[model samples]
Target: MAHFPVNHPARPLYRVLSGLIGLYILVFGVYGVAETWGDGLFSREDTSALGLRTNLAFSLVSVIFGAFLIIGASRRGNLGHYMNLTAGAVFLVTGILMMSVLQTQVNILNFSMATVIVSLLFGLILLATGLYDKVGTEEHAEEERRRREHPIAEAHR
Candidate 1:
C-alpha cells in the first residue's frame, strides 16, 4: 500500500490503462449479468460477451475482478500494475483454453476467435504496463536517489 507520487514519470500511463481495462471489464460483466438476471445463474441458452454462456454467478465474479482492477488502478502505487499482470495472465490462459476446448466441452465459460485474440492482446498490454512502470523498483529508486543527492546545476545563460 505504498503511495507513489501521481507525478511519477510513468504514473499517468499506469493509471489510464488500468482504469480503462477495469472499466471495460466491469461493463462487460455487468452486461452479462443483466442479460441473464432472471435465468437462474447459468442459462443453458444465453450467449454473452465473448460467446460465453452468461451466468449470474460467474458474471458477478467478473464484476468483482473488474472492480479490483479499477480500485487498484486508482492508486499511485504498484498494486494496480501487479493486479493487471495477474489478471491478464488469467484471461489469456483461460481464453486460449476455452478456444481449444470449445467443441468438446459444454462450458458456460465459452470462447470464440475474437475472444481468444482479445484476451491474448489485453493480457500482453497488462504485462507490459506492469513491467514497465513500477515505482519502487531498483532502477527507479536509484534514479530518485540520484536526483535528490545531485540536483542539476542551473544554466547561467
Candidate 2:
C-alpha cells in the first residue's frame, strides 16, 4: 500500500501553495475570457493570457478547475487529499493529451508549449501536496513514522 504522510509538518505550506496556484489559474482564466470574448469556443486564433495560449473553451474549463482547487485547498480533511489527487491526475493527463495534439486540428485548448509545461508543473506540485497533506491524529502520524523507520518490524507485526 502507498504510505502518505499523516499530519505532515509542512501541510500549511502545501495548502498555501495550492491556493496560490488556484488563484493564478483563476486570474488567468478571467483574463483569457476577457481577451477572447468574441472568439469561437475553440478559436485557433493566437490569443495569450498570462503567458499562456488559451481559447474560450479552455478559459471556461480553467475557471471551473481553479475554483475546484481553491475549494480543495481550504478543506481540513481527507476530502482535500482526494481532491488534490484527482486534480493532479487531471492536470497531468490534460497536459500530455494537449501536447500530443499540439500541432493538430484537435488542439481545442489552444495549448502552447508554455501552457503544457505549466500544466505538468502544477500536476506534480499538487500530487506532492496530496501525498503529504493527509490529516490525522498525532498517534496516527507517530505510527506512520514508526512504520516508515522500521518497515520490516512493522510488516512482521
Candidate 3:
C-alpha cells in the first residue's frame, strides 16, 4: 500500500532558499544587462587585458539561466533545486575572483565590498539550507523509527 507523508521541516526552508536564489539571479542578471548595455560590454580593462568579451553575450546567457532557476524553483522540481544550489556556490566563487581582479584594476573599495557581501550572503544561505535539509531528513527518520516502535502511544485519534 502507498502512503502519503507530511512535509518535512527541511522541505520548506529548502524551497524558500531556492526561490530566493532564483530571484537573486534574475535581479543580478538584469542589473548586469543594464550595466553592460550602457558601458559597451566588457570593462575596457577586462577586454584589453584578457581579450574577454563581457558583452551582451554574457548578460543574455545569465538572464536565460536565471529564468530557468525561477521556473525550476516555482515548480519545486528535483533538478532545479540542485542546479540552483550549485549556481549559488558558483556565483560566490566567481564574484570573489572577479572582485579581486577588478580591485587590482580599479580603486573602488565600495564596489569590491558590495560584491564580497553579496557573495557571502548567497553562499551562506545555500550552505545553511543544505545543512538544514540533511539534518531534517535524519530527524524525520528518527521520528519515524520512534513512531514505529511506540505505535499506539504516538498515534493520534
Candidate 4:
C-alpha cells in the first residue's frame, strides 16, 4: 500500500467553493422550474419561443453537475482535479452564447449581469484550483527531494 500526503488546508477551501457552486445550481434549477410554472405553464413570450426548453435543459444539467461536485467534495474524491477547469470552460461558452446569440431585444441588463457574474466566478474558481494543485505538487516534490538527500540525518529504525 502507498501512503499519500496529509490533506492540505486548501482542500477545505476547494470543498467550500464546490458547495457554493452546488447551491448556485440547485437554486437556479428550482427557481427556473417554479418561474415557468408560476407563469401559467410556460405561456410567456420567452417560453413560447424557445427560452423555456433551453433554460430547463441548462438548469437540469447544472443541478446534476452540482450534486456530483458536492458529493465528490464531501468524499474527498479527486473531482476537484478537473471540475474547476471543466466548469470554467462551460461558463465561458455559455456566457458567450448568452451575450451574443441569445441577446434579447428588451431587458438586456439583467441577462448580461447574470451571465457575467457566473462567468467570473467560474474563472476565479478555475484559477484558484489550478494554482492550489500546482502548489501542492511543488510541495510534494520538495518533500521527496529532502527525504532523499537527508535520509541519514532523520533516520528511522
> Relative to the true structure, how large is the alpha-carbon lDDT of every model?
0.68, 0.93, 0.55, 0.53
In model 2, what is the error at residue 103, expressed in angstroms?
A: 0.3
lDDT of 2 by residue, 34-74 (tens): 99999999998999999999999999999998899899999
By the TM-score metric, which is better: model 1 or model 2? 2
Q: Estimate each model's TM-score.
A: 0.72, 0.94, 0.56, 0.58
Order by TM-score, highest first: 2, 1, 4, 3
Residues 47-148 of candidate 4: C-alpha lDDT, one tens digit per residue: 311132324445455567667556544554455645655665666666665666444553222244455566566657754553343224557767755666
Summing lDDT over every window of 10 consecutive residues in candidate 2, give the lowest-scoring window: 2-11
lDDT of 4: 0.53
Writing each residue's lDDT as its tens digit, candidate 1 over 41-64 gives 544554676454556766787799
* Residue 14, candidate 4: C-alpha displacement in angstroms: 2.1
Maximum-TM-score candidate? 2
**How many clashing pairs in candidate 1?**
0
Q: What C-alpha lDDT, on a 0 to 100 scale, does residue 39 get in candidate 4?
A: 48
lDDT of 1: 0.68
Among residues 3 or more apart in sequence or in different chains, the pairs in candidate 1 whose N, CA or C atoms overlap within 3 Å are none
Runs in model 3 deviating more than 4 A are: 1-7, 44-62, 105-111, 131-157
Ranking of candidates on lDDT, top first: 2, 1, 3, 4
Query: In model 1, which runs have C-alpha deviations exceeding 4 angstroms?
Result: 1-8, 44-46, 49-53, 137-157
